[model samples]
Target: MPGIPVTAPDAGKSALRRRLLAARAALTGDEVAAAGEALATRATALPDLAGARTVAAYVSIGREPSTRTLLERLRATGTRVLLPVLRPDNDLDWAAYEGPDALVRAGRGLLEPSGPRLGRAAVTGADAVLLPGLAVDRRGLRLGRGGGSYDRVLARLEAAEARPALVVLLYDDEVVDEVPAEPHDRPVRAAVTPSGVRRFGGVEEVEG
Candidate 1:
């Protein structure tokens, strides 16, 4: 979990993303699939999601810890799941998840929900948000893919004075000791790994 040596935030983030993405790419398909199942179990059990009516989530692609199982489970429980639709400017526009069949292949190795677009402000109404990230530090600072998509989501929430629980899904090893923090980088409230969920800040652990 050594952070990049560069002083610039963008430089540091680029280096970290390259390293983490390479490591994830090295994982076997079987490993990724198993991790996805475990992640689904751990994520669903989080207390933050207990009574959530609407959840902002994403569809995982390639070596990223998969969200297919988690999305299915959430939908089955009658949770209003919203998946991201990549916008022209790279900002995310959300839409209702109507199961796997509703997903359409998008550029940059992404699968997006094909439902009606719910404007950018839709994320602020979610009871919880499951973010995609390369790694998360002990402080809950998440290292995203540098697309600035989730950054906009967070900024919108802040502007609206929303307090939805922010969470990141990752493999166990992706939870690191530290990651370079920036002024705009928002710390997550919790992280769900294959083993279990871990709380940060003043967040409390979910009881089994």
Candidate 2:
């Protein structure tokens, strides 16, 4: 939710983002709930998540695939969960997820962890990162809201030389053959959809 808005030069990407957001907004509340549960089931089974001690994830807002269920499941399994806090500059800061009760409403009508702030660099310690996206290409390029928050997150990880498994959560249809790519966009290792988990090139294979 913290990505910067796409500019005029990104007209094409902007149009696609609007279309996808509109389609997501069309889902019924019940449909979103069911998809969230199914996505959690599939995501929790990934070996990347299964072995993770610290996972960098975010609270799903609006019609996005819900990370709420997945967050709780990760905590239940003794994993330390980190959620993002939006910085004024649109960069993301980190905070530990204490549970649903620990969440507080913040800017742009989104929920954020109500815990001590962990520096932006804190994400470098993650074993995996569950990214939010409107769509991901087979090449694992994630199309995030123009806000650029996760873009900074990825850059931070790269600067720190962290090699955490980067995973995206989306509905089954959001996995496309391709999306508009940018020079700075980093490829994700995998995507977890309600239908199943899909791995891309350079990703580690998850065992059944």
Candidate 3:
């Protein structure tokens, strides 16, 4: 007989996320390209991008598909881009980004910007922020890589009364009804999937 079963909800969800990440990484080249195209297209149409003076976006890494095209497009529109730097204290340090060249390999083998190190004050000035996640829900809850780095940064943003629009990027199937949100989890305002953007926790109806 099998050993006494363990059935913690959190444990089950963690297992599911691991499986999902593995499967997502196995996506075909065509699938990845299509998804990237869709994300870029929808991002261009986002209302937040129209007048955003400052924007913060993550530099993609690993099996994570590239956002080079999207970043280039955003830069062309004159939106200031800022990238996150992993600090030793487990918090995020932001830096001004001019282009791809500003990036250098950093924490967890991810590429990060090598520009002027800005403080949390710069994050508060941003009109929009693009967050990274393993999965997300319509409620704006995100499942990150368990670093708590983003949560820490977002918490600072919340305390400042300058709530920039938070957007999480994910694959289409990664958008679900619910995700296990911890007490310290910082909720986003919306999610951008391969199909389109969904306004999480918003009253406005989302159009496909």
Q: What is the C-alpha RMSD of each candidate to the true structure, in Å?
A: 3.3, 4.9, 5.4
Count of steric clashes across candidates, in order: 0, 5, 0
Q: Candidate 2: how many backbone clashes?
A: 5
Kindly list the per-residue Cα lDDT of model 3 for residues 68-175, writing each as its tens digit.
Answer: 667888899888888888888888889988888878988679788898899866788899998888777656778787777887778888889888988887787776
- Candidate 1 lDDT by residue in tens digits, 90-133: 88889999999989999888998888998999999999999999
- Which residue window of length 10 is worst by lDDT in model 3? 1-10
Worst 10 residues of 1 by lDDT: 1-10
lDDT of 3 at 124: 85
Off by over 4 Å in 1: 1-11, 202-208
TM-score of 3: 0.88
Rank candidates, TM-score, best first.
Answer: 2, 1, 3
Over 24-66, each residue of candidate 2 has an lDDT whose tens digit, in order, gives 9999989999999998998889999999999999999989998
* Number of the top lDDT candidate: 2
